[model samples]
Target: MAKLALLVATFALAFLVVNASIYRSGHSSCERQIRQEDNLRHCQKYLEEECSDSPYNRPGRYLDSCCQQLENLERECRCEGLQHAVRQQLEEGEWEREEARELFQVAKTILRKCPNFEEPRRCEMQSRRWF
Candidate 1:
């Protein structure tokens, strides 16, 4: 379920770059959540393509990008952000739940690859694995 959460979170917060990550919307929390979810559905495919490193070290440095994208989040909020991105991507792609779990595991395995990555333990995605 890690990949699912990764994909979903990555796409869900496509707004990560669009200013929503730090957005102070006048809308209610519920409305904002819905909007984030919708954005995930609409943009997960592109985000995955741009944010993934699998299928041969993606060109855009998706992990670095993800790190940067999530950097501004509070410590506890980091995993939540990841989960949202993964979930969006997974949901949009119709991938299996197991993929999400594996992706999370894969992510943990490769954590050292991102020297500067600072995702806290909550982002461990221990409940999932990655390719």
Candidate 2:
């Protein structure tokens, strides 16, 4: 009976360790997601407030305050956030097809011009469609 109790206690300890590890990992993942979301929000606000006025129709001027904004964002995270914003605008009819495409091009340019920015390998602009 003593041996059986020892065996049961060993199994319970192992189970508790595994459960604790899983909980910690899950919590960290949640925290990382929240941080990414906050970063995305900051990028979006910067784009709207500082970049919108410049418009991409002209050269050089487009990057004015935009480069500063992109510089502050996580490279891959900002790419994902920009793609999401463009798609959301297109789907919701908040922007015309041409305007959305222009916005995307502007984002790409900002990523290219910003110092230390690395373009995401998997980031692809959505295909243009006629409305």
Say which candidate scores most in lDDT. Answer: 2
- Show how many residue pairs clash in every candidate, following the order shown: 34, 0
What local distance difference test score does each model get?
0.50, 0.54
Q: How far is candidate 2 from the true structure (C-alpha RMSD, Å)?
A: 8.2
Best by TM-score: 1
Candidate 1 contains a number of clashing pairs equal to 34
How well does each candidate superpose onto the true structure, as a TM-score? Answer: 0.44, 0.41
Q: What is the C-alpha lDDT profile of model 2 across 1-131, one tens digit per residue?
A: 99999999999999999999998886565445535555344434433433344454344543434445445545544565556545544554555555656656655544655566656533465545524
Q: Residue by residue across 1-131, what tens digits does model 1's lDDT show? A: 99999999998688676676445442344344534445333223334554454686444345554554444444454454555556666655644556555545544433344456555533455343334
